[model samples]
Target: MTGGLPLSGVRILDASHVLAGPFATYQLCLMGADAVRVERIGGDDFVRHHGGSAELRTQGMGGSFAAQNAGKACILLDLKAPGGRDVFLKLAAACDVVMENYRPGVMDRLGVGYADVKAMKPDIVYCSLTGYGPQGPFADAPAYDHIVQGVSGLMSMTGTKDSGPQRMGLPITDYIAGLTAALAVAGALHQKRATGEGQHLVVPMLASVLAFMGSYAIDAQTLGRERGLQGNAPFSGSPFAGRFDTVDGHLVVTANTAAQAVRMVRALGLADLEPLAAGTAPDALSEADRARVAEALDRTFRTRTALEWEEALGAAAVPAGKVRGLGEILAHPQTAAMGCLDDLPLPGLEDPVKLPGLGFTSDAWTRRPLSEPEAPGQSTRDVLAGLGLSRREIDDLARAGAVAGPGLPPRSA
Candidate 1:
């Protein structure tokens, strides 16, 4: 993976845990960076024990943790301890990037904050992912994905009016923040390479959500558009841009342009609505007319299966698709064509775990095959040994509750 990617040979110390910070470092790993996750001594990432079923969590390969931490090495150091902090600073001096997702003052109190790290590594890109920025009224308040979702108005914009505000099923904000952090870190790395200067980055989930919702807020301010739940409908209220039920399942048909509307109406056997399809703004239709057309379309769509409608609409070049579940998506032919999923071996699991790889691909570079996710402290001894710690010193640190490694007793507080 390190062969020809843009971030090849970049060394990163990933002191982040759970989703957001870990995912940022994971992105760097995909770009061929030598990213190592430094776990707390004697502790695993909360995600490792929080998600998935009891069976999976007991195996210590909770689905979420495995997905986010794939392709990274794990080492443990009790940074509160003097010996451990020294080892961390040593690693910082040798690495290009140091990343964490601790709260604002936690890192400073731990004595491994950016200022502390910068003194040891003059050209280090230090990135922090926090719930809110370093200084804000809510900065000190603890935040997670769902809390930010509600605070950012994202929850208000989801679901239908009847269901009220509904949270998105996944940790969307966390993933978005992680992706943004990765991009920011990459830019900082590029600048450092060119000018020999490092950077301190503070990425906040609140800021990331606002950025993601920028267009929405701008539209409200500039166009007097009110934010409201529209369910499966497009915000524009385009009649064609909604879901309709078929015999078996739902089909999403989006015909935004005049030509697309024409094709869609013609395909659905609703020629009477052809004029409306031909550049007629949805609001131009009377309520009666809109209701009549929706009724007709719904009746017609129910005559066939979702797949049947999808194929028919596709043939007419009107954008359409059947709403699919995860199982269907995994079985779909397009999923195979995308080549975005891989099966990696995991310890104690009988079957190789299938997981999504990079969201995109490049002709110029290829991601290396994924290695299984590592257990906490899985590579501690090797990492310390690489840092010039002798076997006796490494063993001493383990014995003194300052460090942990594979097969060694977890350090006690």
Candidate 2:
């Protein structure tokens, strides 16, 4: 491990699951924070078998679980049980941060809510992430990424005008919530350092998604204009910006600037089809003119392969690249040069698994060597031992189903 990761020495007790909560803690874990994921005794994270192939579920290493949960330890404590709640309080008292992402009041009902944990550790940074917020009409509604996307107006603004509303291909809302929550946690930690006071942070998926749609929301309110999908068109409303088909495949090209637009038409040998704007002017072509230009460009782009167009457009300084799928992009030379994708081992897998890397770069943060993703509760005994629990006590708890790990009772069906 490289020295001086930003979150080094910080301890976080993460009692959350699914995507957003786990991902937020995962970020800290990657930065050398001691992120301990606490789950119910004899239970597994729903995501452990949520997606991916049947083989992954059998191996207890689902791709969805491994994708976001690297570099964290797992512990099992039945928080619903009195003994389990006691164990959790003990852990919270020793940790710097505690986080959970249940519906409003779920944690409080569990008796391990923010106030309860803060009582044990006055300066603990606590974050409660939820779908909406603690107090709102929709607060009690169950929400997932897609539901939030639709509610937040993201889906209404995506896709083509012809396709109607469409959900994004990925769980964008969950990730946005996770990233926002991580940022808030970091900021609260910083403030705590100066004031010697902990913070209670509320990270709402609806709020995060709205933040992502800030510009659109502002436009709707201020200009009385609601933006609609334009199907691969750039949000800037530039007619010169969209995906095009090459002789062999497709490519995405954006000539948003006037100069680039001129260069693009000229590059395609369509000098006669000069744009109405020039030299930093905004795209103002009428519908008919835009259609004519697009038709001509389409014919021209079809004259060359995607790679050829990519090179030619790149040489002319127009922003463009060949359209690529997930597999192709992951295996691309650029990804390899950045050291962003790695094949690491997963639990019950004989071979290394390929996964994406961190989003940001830091000279002081080197990813530690990869270890197989641990099964839920795999470290329960060791974690309890670190809390100074005697072997007899640990055994007693396990036998009573208050704590579970390798030798514990089978989960109720």
Candidate 3:
């Protein structure tokens, strides 16, 4: 394990918004990168105004925005304004990385695209995250998580036979794209360190989602069949590997191996059913045998509570868990032990807000001190100053409607 955060001293100029782009930069910030996001002069990130909590939304710290944007600064710049692009270019020159998620040509139209930034900072690692690849037929099409989910065939395969083409409960594609972009940026940064040469990373959400569903895609192509929604059933096709009803709740058991299937049956006190699995290969049971085993297990599981079955199956080396709600899981002892939530102190809120911490733990990685998500343009003055702009120049820019921030005079109506 390393002794400190790996990306310390790295600087990211983030012009991304919504989930994917912000999330990618947020991941890097969690690893100790100094990230400064540039919002439009009068506009905020879409997530900044929408989320579960109305109060937070009104405060410009919506729950969705707070989820991944902690520890980052914000500056507001109207790139269409006369000096706005100049200001962005200056910031880009000082940044080690520039990340944006605008559509294919929006950044170029604004005169702050990858080419423009690369011209200023030859070794800058630039990442352009979009819905589609930069040179595709659909490159100009706008997309959100749900759009990508539909386009990538994820929605088509998600639900049961009765509820066809259902969307996932969460914005899974956005998260996948974010993770992919973060990984690409990390790799590019590694290469830059090694060779002092930067690279442009074009991460498309559609491609990211497709890669995430590689297994299913390959299966569909190889078997020439679509495995329509099996609904809670493990893709491995084990009859014993799925959600089953219990007296009090539900339990999910994944007995994916031959030994595990046998052990699960035995643990459930279904000795009569043991023969069905004793010599059979996992996922290779005959249709009749599969139905029989599944029926027996389902009937037996109903005799006890989900937790009771979880304990018994777990002790028998079966992979099992009781279905839990978000609140229950968050409050679980295991979650507490993981220390994956950080308390952030926002200015207006009476109590500190709890946000997620680094998703993984390592002995070598040190946790950066928790910082609150910035309100739009919260750090405009300081960030501009860091770019070597004088107070007079910043004030002039604000007056000219090119920039806006707290304590600065509002842009002329």
Q: What's the lDDT for candidate 2?
A: 0.82
lDDT of 3 by residue, 147-180 (tens): 9999998887788888878889999999999999
- Write candidate 1's Cα lDDT for 187-227 as tens digits: 99989889999989999999998998877899789988756
For candidate 3, list the clashing residue pairs, or say none: 2-364
Q: Which candidate leads the pack in TM-score?
A: 3
Q: What is the C-alpha RMSD of each candidate to the true structure, in Å?
A: 2.0, 2.2, 1.6
Model 3 residue runs over 4 Å out of place are 278-283
Inter-residue clash pairs, candidate 2: none
Report the lDDT of model 1 for residue 346: 72
TM-scores across all candidates? 0.95, 0.94, 0.96
lDDT sort, best first:
3, 1, 2
Best candidate, lDDT? 3
Q: Global lDDT of each model? A: 0.85, 0.82, 0.87
For candidate 1, the per-residue lDDT at 329 reads 93
The list of candidate 2 runs beyond 4 A from truth reads 42-44, 275-283, 348-350, 409-413
Task: Using TM-score as the measure, name the better of candidate 1 and candidate 2.
Answer: 1
